[model samples]
Target: MAYRVQGVVVREKDAPATIETVIVPDPGPGEAVVDIITSGVCHTDLHYQQGGISDDFPFLLGHEATGRVSAVGEGVTEIAVGDRVILNWRAVCGQCRACAKGQPQYCFNTHNATQKMTLEDGTELSAALGIGAFIEKTLVAAGQCTKIDEESDAAAVGLLGCGVMAGIGAAINTGEVKRGESVAVIGCGGVGTAAIAGAQLAGATTIIAVDIDDAKLEQAKRFGATHTVNSKNEDPVAAIQALTGGFGADVVIDAVGRPETYKQAFYARDLAGRVVLVGVPTPEMQLELPLLDVFGRGGSLKSSWYGDCLPSRDFAMLIDQYKLGRLDLDGFVTERVGLGDVEASFAKMGDGTVLRSVVEL
Candidate 1:
């Protein structure tokens, strides 16, 4: 039987999202139906609405979600009905080259539900990140559901489905931060602050947070930053170097994804150290650097896609840390608003008034 539920939809580019009734088909082969409990209002959703992602009009706008498996289709055996899970965008195809090579994080072929959900008028909806979850129920490939502890707050743990996971994985997976190391994170937004928390979890002795906004810098400290640098008033590169004993940090992560921030991250790392770019850069942006400086840096320059995360492994592990009270997942939830307030939450996101304004379903 088909299910009808209200979902947030962006009908046209730059148009405000509207709440409309969507029809969710019963689970098809290898698919599962999830009763979504909560979803996070992320920048990606806003980007999708603005046509920044693609021309897939009538797009379903949320992906970071936690839910319970209400039903499963034929051939689905991993997750049973009533299982608590977090929905993930990356559903690795084990046969893909990346997965076959034992690096499923870069799975060459990811999967989504074969079936499509449509409007009451029968218009197909392009789900954001292949997991449209800003509704009462959503359908996705069984692999997209990562089961975690049910005791944890869904609003908090669901964030691991997207941005928070990206930030944490940028440090622990892509950056490979180590104990006793000195680390610096550029941009104190949600991702950067999560990187700071990841560094602390990895036991980094000196964790420096850099940002133009003093308020965000303070939030970064609450997320485990040992030092803060207001980039607008000071030179971030020099400040990071000074904080690391006149030598640059061992690892520097650029979370803002701008050319200037990338340059700062490049020059703010110690010789033979690593620079990780976890920020999503705009298509028109370009970087220019001297070849001599590139050679002189003598370290790795890497880009992290979705924080190079392996959902099945990283999600559960991080949830365990949260349950142990080691990770401050709750701190990331600055506000909880209903589905109707998602547009307003986007405004707050632009103003930097909240770390994350989650949409409680």
Candidate 2:
């Protein structure tokens, strides 16, 4: 039997999302049905509303979620009914070239439910990030369910499902930040601030935060930034160099993703230092750097896809840290709201009023 649930859905390009009746079918083989407890509103959800992600109309618009498995399908042994889990998009296929090489974080093939959740009239709604978790309950592959400590706060730790995890992973995994290293994160949004916290967690001695917004810069300080630079009034590259003892940082992460910020990150690192680009860029955006300068820099320039995170490994570790009071996952939740408030939260998110507005199901 299919369960009737309410989900936030975008019906057309640039259309505001609305609550609609979603038909969540019983899991098929290798699938599980999750009863969502909480879901976080991310910029990616807004991007779906604005037609930035795809032309897949009627997209189910949430992914960062925590849920309990309510049912499991045949052959689904990895997860069982009643498991507390954090939803993840990367359900790595072990045979994929990336996974076979032991880099499951770069898995080229991930799994989703073989069955589709539909509208009352049978229109198939595209699941955002392959999770479609804005609804009361969602069906997903069993591998998508990563079991975590049930005592962890659902509203807060669910962020590990996406953006928060991306930021932390960008620092810890992609950048491979080392103890006593000097690190600079460009952008003080959710991802950038998380990078600051991740740097602290990784034992970085100096963390510099660069942003145009003074308020955000201040917030970054709470996340363990040692110094804040207002790029609006100063040359950020020069400022970073000056702060790092006339040398640049060991690692500079571009969290804003624009060409200008990328340039700043490129030049804000010490010779042979790493620059991690965790921010998502549009398809139309082209990066043109001088070939000689690229060779002259003599450093690694890498892009972080999903922060190079291996969810099965990272999620549990992060949840345990949150429980140990070592990580401030709660700091990321700026507001708690009901499902209808998601559209309003989008406006606040645009104006930088909130880090994340989460929907508590």
Candidate 3:
């Protein structure tokens, strides 16, 4: 049977997200219905409201979520009802060339539920990041659910579904920050701080956090940054170099996703060091750099899609780490709000006042 639930939805560009009656149909083949416990208010959700992601109006927003399996449809076998899980956008299609090559993190063709959630009038709603989790219940591809330890807090680990995972994966998976290496993350937002924490876990000896906001830089310290650079007061690239004894960091991640920050990441790394871009940029933006600088920088320049993570592997491992007190997933949840507060929470995100405003369902 289809379920009726209230969800946050943006009807048009520049419109405020309002709670709407969403129709979540019973899962079809290869789909599952989840009773969401909590969902985080991520920047991506805001992007959907602003139409920065697509022209698909009537976007069912919210993606970072954790929930319990409530129902499964035909042919779904990997997960069962009552299992705790984190939702992931990238449900890899194993037959895709990227997945067939064992690089499923870069799966060229990801999957979502074939069925659509609709408005009361039968208007189709595009699920944000293909999950559309800001509701009491959501339908998703069976593969999109990754079971995790039930003991974990739904509000905390739910963040692993998106921004947080991207940040951590940028450092640990993409940059491959090794023990005792110097690491710098530009943009001390939720994603950037996760990169710092990831670097710390990977044993980065000197973790430098650069951001325009001093408060965010301070918050980065709790995430294991050894030094903070207020870019508004100093040149971040220069500060990063100075902190690393004028040699530059071994890995520099651009989490701000602007041309300026990308250039900073490009120049802030040591020779042969890695630069990982995890920040989402608008299509109107363009980047130009001297060809000589590209050649002079003899290391990898990579973009992180959901932190290039394999959810089945990374989510459970990170959840265990959180349970073991090694990873601070709890630190990411700044405030807990009900679903109705999503718009107000979105406003707080602009000032970097909260790491996350989670909607606890």
- On lDDT, the leading prediction is 3
Tens digits of per-residue lDDT for model 1 on 1-361?
9999999999999899889999999999999999999999988998898888899899998999999999999999999999999999899999988988999999989999999999999999999999998888999999999998779999999999988998998999999999999999999888888899999999999999999999999889888999999999999999999999998999999999999999999999999999999988877899999999999879899998888999988988998899898999999999999888888999999999898999987
Candidate 3 lDDT by residue in tens digits, 1-361: 8899999999999899999999999999999999999999999999989889999999999999999999999999999999999999989899999988999999999999999999999999999999999999999999999998767799999999998899999999999999999999999999999999999989999999999888898899999999999888999888999998898999999999999999999999999989999999999999999999899879999998899999999998888888989889999999999989999998999877999999999
Each prediction's Cα RMSD? Answer: 0.8, 0.8, 0.7
Candidate 2 residue-wise lDDT, 1-361, digit = tens: 9999999998999888899999999999999999999999999999889888899888998999999999999998888788899999999999999988999999999999989899999999999999998899999999999997767799999999999999999999999999999999999888988889899999999999999999999999888999999999999999999999988999999999999899999989999999999988876888888989889989899999888999989998888888888789999999999989989999999999788999999
TM-score of 1: 0.99
Candidate 3 residue spans exceeding 4 A from truth: none
Error (Å) of candidate 2 at residue 135 is: 0.7
Error of 2 at 18 (Å): 0.3
To one decimal, what is the Cα RMSD in angstroms of model 3 from the true structure?
A: 0.7
Q: State the lDDT at 214 in candidate 3.
A: 84
Each model's lDDT: 0.93, 0.93, 0.94
Deviation of model 2 at 122, angstroms? 0.8
Candidate 1 Cα outliers beyond 4 Å, as residue runs: none
